[model samples]
Target: MLSLIVSNPLFGVVLTLGVYFAAQKLQEKTNFALLNPLLISSIFIIILLSVTNIDYDSFNKGGSFLTMLIGPATVALAIPLYKNLALLKKHYRVILVSTLSGVIAHAILIGLFTFILNLSPEMIATMIPKSVTTAIAIDISNQLGGITTLTISVVIVTGILGAALAPILNKFFKINNPIAQGLALGTSAHAVGTSKAVEMGEMEGTMSSLALIITGITTVLLAPVTQAIIHSLYF
Candidate 1:
């Protein structure tokens, strides 16, 4: 009976939503940076699955539906960008340059560290898109013949780290400009980081939203090229 319940797709969906909602409520009550919804919910689900001996394939049956929603959810971020259109136009060049640079630097650093650690070609490929949103990152990982599960895990960890640490890093680095803060957060952390940016200011949220979109596009376009380079150098 327990196995039967866990095997249902709706069970996976309900478990995911329930855990996330609980995590959100906990964060709201605590106002703690470390109690991130994504991080907490992921950990909860992992434990639940492990304890129940439920396989990933069973959970993913409904989880894939949630994954499918990511594309539209990303498109929704444009609403914030649209609201800040004038500001975006005023600093278009800065936004473009900063986002592109951040994306390239992120990829390069991941490759550099992976190579230095002597990670396998597959592992390196999985880590390439770790800074982007899970939707785009999974696609890129699949294209590169990397493990999507590992890519998603890396992306989640990166976003949580960015969201939790952005404030401290900003103060330490003396990054007071809203635009810079948003771009840095979004480029490095994706949607999870953008959530933290929203708490800072409207302009910062808008900029983070724009950065997330642009970074996703940039990473997708660059994935094949990066994969080829990795193959030549590592494979």
Candidate 2:
């Protein structure tokens, strides 16, 4: 039954949904933060891949239909952005400053350290867009002459690290405001961070939704400037 199901192209999609449903139910019963549905599903998938010796390519073949939803979901993010446009306009100046500061700081830190450490130039270029979502990150990396694979890896690492530490970082910095919290999460973890912000509350989720669009745009605009600066400094 398992082998037959996995052999079908739709199996991955079905299994993923099944896993999510089960995990959600378990979360309701346990109320354990560490046992998040995403975490559990990810672990299950990873272990399945390892035990079965099924490479990502095969899994993706089966799962690509579900993965394709990413496009529509990203597009759906624009609805919230539109709804918050008025509030965004009111705080436009601060929003611009904060996002630009975070994005630029991330680029500089990654570029400088990677360059200093003698990492490949491709790696540095890829690292420049790590703070954005994977789709945007890959696009920016492609435009900046970077490796897409490395960009994906770094983006994942950045998101996981940011999501894991966001609460602690927020407390340490005493930035309890919803706007700041959401901005921090969106800037650092992309969609994953936004998920965390949603749990924080409506205000945080609103800001996070705004941050997602703002950060993506900001990173796209800053990528070239950042690449230029890193180019001059490192080369």
Candidate 3:
């Protein structure tokens, strides 16, 4: 039975969601920081992956289902966004400027780091869209001459890490304002971070959703320009 479970292609994803849901249950039962669903699910999946000889591709075959849901889930955020159009209209400038800054900062910071480290151009391309959600990131990476596999991995990692740390970082930086908090999570972390932000509060969720949309637009617009600049500098 155990061998069968391990051999199944979708085992990792099934295991991951199972762990995530279980962790959610634990959260409902107790107000414990240690019960974070993302953390628990990640640990479980890591352990499973490490112990088994199964390759990631095989695991992802099953796991890809969960990943596919990301698109629809992202679109669903529009429902909440539409519901809060009034608040959004009132804060349009704040939302617009903050998201633009976040997108610009994302491109510059990652580009600068890669440049300073003298990484390969291929690696730099792979990382250029690291701040966007996986779907958009993968598409942009391909257009920018980046490795799709590397771009996907970076997007997933960025989302998971951002979701895991945002709360603490938000508190540490004393970012109590919902708009700032939402934009921070949306711009830095993408969908996963936005999920956590939505849980934090309604305003945070709306702002995060807005950030996600605007960030996507900005990144798409900026990719070509940034690519031209990078080429001039490196080529």
Q: If the candidates were sorted by their lDDT against the true structure, best first, what order would they fall in?
A: 1, 3, 2
Each model's TM-score? Answer: 0.92, 0.83, 0.77
- Per residue, candidate 2 scores C-alpha lDDT tens digits across 1-235 of 7666567777677767888789878977985555666667767887988998767766677578876775776678688889999989988887788788888788878876866787667777778888888767777988988998778777766776777788888899898898889888887788778877888999887777788778988899988998788777767
lDDT by residue (tens digit), candidate 3, 1-235: 7667766866867777788899779866985544556656766776867787666777787787887886786577567668878977999899889888888887787768767887677777788899988778877898988999778767777887887788888889898898899988888888877887888998798788878877887898998887777767766
Where is model 1 more than 4 Å wrong at Cα? 77-83
Model 2 spans > 4 angstroms off: 1-4, 20-40, 145-150
Task: Go through the candidates in order and give each one's C-alpha lDDT.
Answer: 0.87, 0.79, 0.79
lDDT per residue (tens digit) for residues 90-169 in model 1: 98999899989988898688768767998787887799999898878888899888899889889999998999899999
* CA displacement after TM-score superposition, residue 204 of candidate 2 (Å): 1.7
Error of 1 at 108 (Å): 1.7
- Candidate 1: clashing pairs of residues: none
Q: CA lDDT of 194 in candidate 2?
A: 84
Residue 159 Cα positional deviation in candidate 2, in Å, after optimal superposition = 2.6
